[model samples]
Target: MRPICLPERVAARAFPPLAPIAFACSLALQLSPARAQNALSVEPDTTAGSVPLRVLDARVRLGGERVRLPGRENMGLAGLTELLNVGGEWWVGPGVYGAATGHRGGLFVPGVEGAWSHPFNDWLAVDTGVFAGGGGGAAAPVGGGLMLRPHVDLVFRFPGFYTGPTFSKVWFTSGQINSNQFGWMLNVDSSFRYRPADFHGTATDGSATGLGFDHVDATVTMARPRNSTSTAGTPMTQRIGLVGLRAERSVDGPFWAGIEAAGAGSGGVAGYAEVLGTAGLRFPVVGDRLSLGVRGAVGLGGGGAIDTGGGLLVKASAGMTLRLTDTLGIGAELGLVDAPDGHYKAETAAVSLNWALDVPQRDLSDWFNTRPGTPTRMEFGTGVERYRAARKDGRTEALEAVVLQVNRFVAPDVYLTGQAHSAFAGGAGAYSVGLFGIGAQMPVSQRVRLGAEALAGAAGGGGVDTQGGAVLQARAYADVALTDSLSLRVAAGKIKSVHGGLDAPVVDAALVFSFGVDHKH
Candidate 1:
């Protein structure tokens, strides 16, 4: 069997936690009121019946854990997460964890977690939560890639943030790894602001909300390993293909900062992935239609038999872009990848399509008067999905996962969406996927609506056969409104590999929360 490892740096954890937590917190603080207040509670206390959904809070945290490889090899993992305070002292968000020590190079996990914070006094607090996700690449034994972590932290509160030590357990339920470890965490507090889901289709004075990011890019990248070494002390010859997404905001004229994530989709290197924090600058070369730029990134990655010693990585690149429209562009770049703690090096090239969103720039002085721009319609929710017999080795068991989805309506009946899924059952742990596309829906009854969506993106790991890592799926779904802001959604679809033999039927159920923001563009 090929030595399992992970991919290069694009996004996710390390360094006692992921850096994006701090990065994301800073962005939120820029859009928050200047007054000092508790980060855990942004809204006044109210019963759940009075408000279904609203802006909760902004938080950032870091953690660490220890794990065991086969043959008694040991490794340490650093984890980081950024969360949205959703009221009731609860937080929900995404996080990344990667091997920070020992011999494991591409060991990483990216997944979602929900946490609850309780205050014991004005100066002390406690946090308890669980994380669910998947990943495993290099010689790591995260069988099926499913991982569960339950942790607690005791923290000391300051004016705007809190720090403390944490204790937790790491369990790969269907795999060959389980351990208990100690770590640390940090949480930042910020202002709260959000309109209810009932306002999803109404107009509001354009204000900045969410991360307040100004640009996004969808990219396809190719990396050619150059004189790379495997864990077994042999030369690596596989050229890897990747799919990625990046979200960015301008910090100054011609300069920007962003976060990105990518996964292997080709080259038979499934289970390889990366998450990175990036900074770059762009200068106009041909007026506003063309530009040239350079960027640098740092984060954790490993897996796919590639030696990423301790899963710490950094990259530098230079490139150019051509504007295709006011909101879209095409770009290309050349870069070099290096692992400071491992034996991995590569020459990389990529092509990307970019979008400029209409939102407030990264201005820190305009928080008190800002009102977030509203969309015509929007839906955010979580659900569960299952894939029937989708494994590459011809297994018959069904693969089940937890999914998160966001849908935005561009027209009255047409919408665009993005989704992420992490497998938790069917022995397919550590398998994750990201997808984006468009859909259309229409109301068919007083309380019901029907819709269909076509999506394409990248998937890998957990022994699933997503050839070259690219996949296409289409789903038809029905929605029954439970409240103005809440609904029940059920969908059925088929997912097919664009380059391999895995074809399967899929079904899912979700609790969707709908809201609208007014966009003044």
Candidate 2:
């Protein structure tokens, strides 16, 4: 904490009736002359200025009402809310608030909140920030999930403690035909603050102040994942490997927030690029050699690793760093990350090299952010199929089919499809059908891919007596990539052969060979 005494404000603001806590703060700041200004006796020493920029705190946030989900049972505010937070805050630039852990919604209101703060004096400050991210199913509401929080507080400098009231409201960008839900609580916190220059001994000039410099970081990650909503009969993806990069600076005092980019599930079934916003606080742990901190983050991207094909996600983690030299340090963390579709709940471990660009040495505010890789791709293939046809004329026959198809990805996990197929039997003439429509896909791991598609097109051949008609089809399949240019798939689907006068139901199994086309942004 800085030892400088602050000058008192000119007047006291009236306390509002809704918050008794704010009323107490107003009274204290108004009546306590000894503490209203110059509340501490510590002196500022230029020789002792190398203190690491930091902010650490723990609090229990009350999420107080019940939120109604579409089909699942309603959950109380406590259930929809985060339970507690054991993390640090970055007060640098715009400010960052985060906490990574076993589950996401249990702290810091379920995701990273970027807010700004202003200190009135040595004894008071206020903060405001917002949170918006997506992952999970409709159980979390539609694609746009959002939260906002505003805070007010009083500080006690001597023993390093603070207390205040915080309020919040959360809702979906959509859904919630009922109403929005709000939560509030009393935040009692203890924090340790520091900055990079604080470790540089008295280098009070240049980049150490982070005034005109850039902050950069690089790291490698490994995580063990559990299958995302896959059943006992489906293929599964169980792990991921990632390499990442970050660039950010403090907007507030010790709070750092920014975007991070990474490539996970490479050289396997999990191949895609992702980007997310991450934030956290860095505080002093062992003078100049060690540092400990907590981090919170959320992001969106596409890859099989993201079970919903491509969607929003949340992650929570804590880590430590050992400074090896002025601009070089190594760190690692353990945390959990989950996807929106409930496809993956990965337990992760990562190691990184933390550095500052300038020669004087500075601590770069760490916030996690991300950018998505090419989540869109194309597939075209041909396969052999078999089906039993029950004709309207009361004739039933077994047939052989030659099926050709093309699929195009339009979103992270959705696709548009078109296909043509021909069937032949000993006494029966050739039967053909063409189809067009949309579908969805999911990656179970690096090698397995699963999806389903629907299409409608023109039908002709002897089955239609040369008078072509319309045909509709729906199919689901599982794929195993055999090589960079090859993949094999197994599928089953229902075909409505209305044009062929064999309209009841036709089912077929196909052995397909697939190759990809470019994924242009």
Candidate 3:
């Protein structure tokens, strides 16, 4: 087998004071309101006549312990958040995010948001929301102000609808605001959804696979953010925004595929529209209580800061909901994140706990359609390899190898996996044995994981071995799940092998590309 080339550990240093300063002036918006206040409430409103319609409820949170940026003297927090809700003809919420892992006094901000929804009946609803807010940390010179925004949303259920307009503006405190800083956003989106009872031989509700008319959605958006630097002792910012669209289709139970396009620029209008595409699978495990999924995407675009161009993003996640009683339940999520560019990305594994209030018991069909419970599935892969002997006059050989892996829950904190490698070279067919192992997967975040494994396998006839030997390995794998199936994996491992009276030590590193399934139970 070819030796796995490990990636060098790139120290995650603190961000430069100037970088945070630049981001603050460019993207700083607002502090996220606490979740305790926003979580969905089950309290019945006697004044409203009936329980309000649960139109939408979604929350995303990202952060970890304090860490320093590269070549910077600042120590701050790193995290992101996005939340939204539409109920009883009113839509209210906020989308707040920031990277404050730098200066002693970091920057923080939250944008304003509001929306009005009008239900024309049980099937159609028209809604519009606006947001405006901005702030800088203790580093602000003028205490910074807010940016006003206005946008609308139209919803059509079952058959769905497409083609609507969205407009927004960033009104700054003064003209001194960078050119790249001030601009507008214009967007149009159209989507169609279909959920048929049955299609072909695949039942839309069972059998781990569903078939229906492919769903499609298209969106185009334009934005401009000032991007400039001080030249004559005056701060200058440039203005830029990319326009792009994405289309996707989800088969009821098993798989989905999507593609996206967008322009790039720190200021003004982007010159190139970057394109990304992905496809993957999903499956359920543990009697519909857990799901497993994986996915990968490739970027095709320009390079440099103007683009960083394109690369890859991948992730995998598994989740389960525990019912404590009829009306209350608890849930958990564990996953990974990985990206090629560390500056714009980093791999992470995360786990979260949530409590559900007054959740209704889902039927088999509804359970199959909803995607909230999924398991983490192990991935197996194979590739070619070449080995160079250590002694002089030693021959160089090319080999083909197959790798097998299985990731599943063996118990509460323990996970089991097995792998085997077979190779062929020269006139001899050498197989490096089968590896049976088990370990614990400790989640640190939505994109990072720490694991250890022990194995014993036999070598099929490669000179230095007899029968089978034992090996112990510890590995850290960082993964980023961009979608249900596509994910990027960066891992490092150290192993010690003992056989026939001799012990050999080995170290391996790999930047692996993975594509697989993500399913919800």
Clash statistics: count for each candidate: 45, 55, 70
By lDDT rank, best first, the candidates go 1, 2, 3
The TM-score obtained by model 2 is: 0.32
Identify the candidate with maximal lDDT.
1
Residue 88 of model 3: what lDDT?
Answer: 54
**lDDT per residue (tens digit) for residues 115-224 in model 3:** 67566776565555555444322222212223343444444433212212222232324211121111111111111111111111211111111111122222222222
For model 2, the run of ten residues with the poorest summed lDDT: 9-18
lDDT of 1 by residue, 314-352 (tens): 889999999876556899999999888788889999999
Query: After superposing candidate 3, which stretches have Cα over 4 Å from the reference?
Result: 1-93, 96-109, 114-130, 135-142, 150-168, 172-251, 254-282, 295-347, 354-521
Q: Residues 180-217, candidate 2: write the lDDT tens digits.
A: 44333333332212232103233331211211113456
Q: Of the candidates numbered 1 and 2, which has the greater TM-score value?
A: 1
- Model 3 scores worst on lDDT over the 10 consecutive residues at 28-37
- TM values, all candidates: 0.82, 0.32, 0.26
Error of 2 at 417 (Å): 40
